[model samples]
Target: MTIRKATFDETQRILDYALVVLKESTMGFVKPRVEIANLIMAPILADGGYYLIYEKNRTIHGWIGVGTIYDSYSEEVVGTIPEVYVFPAYRGQGVAEKLFHEAFRHLKTENVNKVQLNVFAGNHAKKLYEKIGFHDVSTLMEKDLD
Candidate 1:
């Protein structure tokens, strides 16, 4: 599979991919997932924070979206992985790892030397990440914004 930075022309496809991730990989989110993806997926596609789409022999598979992966408290971007997914039918095929390596190579050029992400404590991907060289640091604590 080949990975490329998504162009704005791929906007609709990106939103579709993100929505799939939210719908299939997560549970109990009250917000309208497609609505959220529609609202937020555009501008970032216009900008560049390692937002990537993966293809196999030129057929679209899936995509990943990331902001500034960084020092959680320092506010300096180390690496970022806002979202990552392979279509349900496409999972278990190492698509995410390829997408990640593509973005990781790009981030290295941007001087982002470390990568960070937040995963719910029980998320299965945490095991995947540990296998890929990421380790648990601390848990994320949150409060509702009003």
Candidate 2:
């Protein structure tokens, strides 16, 4: 498998695959009306972030997106991984580990002081993140009004 950065021309394909994963894992609990491709592209075009994909034989198997967050109060820049998804067929095959390493290599060059990501309480990937040196710093809770 090879890891590479995604191009803007491939935004729609990426968004489609990502949306499927989002819906399946979250049980459609989280829905966004805005074009997610825009969110993925904005950071990359701004030179502040990236989206990396894992591919084999010209087929995309998984992807991870990291966005930049600038803290005005602390004057610090951090990398935030908003999404990481490996296609169901590709799960448990180390695709995510490879993708994370590639993303971190890029982030390291940008002098990002830290990286953060949110994982649902029941997602098994949280263990993978922990094994890769990520620790829980906070808990996020939400209440649905509708």
Candidate 3:
């Protein structure tokens, strides 16, 4: 398998996988799911963000997005891993782990002081993230009223 930078031509493919990842892993509060997904991802490429894709035999198996976010509390620019997804067939083969490490390495080159990502409660990848040294800094709680 090989990992490399994704091209603009591959944005649609990345969005396709991102849609699946969001549907399967998140309980987001948004309407018109497609638009929401696009909104979250569109700026990545336009503003110098990037994704690293993993592939084997010329077929992409997974991807991870790497970008920057200004940390209001710390007053510094930090890395934000907005998304990570591996095809179901490729799960359990360390694709996500490799993507994450590569993203982190890239961020280090950019002088990023830290990195963060959101994990929905009960998501299976949460364990893997913790294994990679991520720890909870805060929590978000909401209650719906109707």
TM-score per prediction, in order, is 0.77, 0.80, 0.92
Clashing pairs in model 2?
Answer: none
**Predicted candidate 2 versus true structure: per-residue lDDT over 1-146, tens digit per residue:** 78888887654577666556565545445674346534644564476565788989999888888777875656788887877888888888999999998888888888887887867777778889999989988787889899
Worst window of 10 by summed lDDT in candidate 1: 23-32
Worst 10 residues of 2 by lDDT: 32-41
| Residue pairs in clash, model 1 | 66-82, 69-79, 69-80, 70-78
Query: Can you give the lDDT of residue 144 in candidate 2?
Result: 81
Arrange candidates by TM-score, descending.
Answer: 3, 2, 1
Q: Global lDDT for candidate 2?
A: 0.76
lDDT of 3 at 90: 93
Candidate 2's clash total is 0
Candidate 2 Cα outliers beyond 4 Å, as residue runs: 25-29, 32-47, 72-75, 143-146
Window of ten residues with lowest summed lDDT in model 3: 24-33
Candidate 1 at residue 110, lDDT? 83
lDDT of 3 by residue, 83-131 (tens): 8888889999999999999899999999997999988877878999999
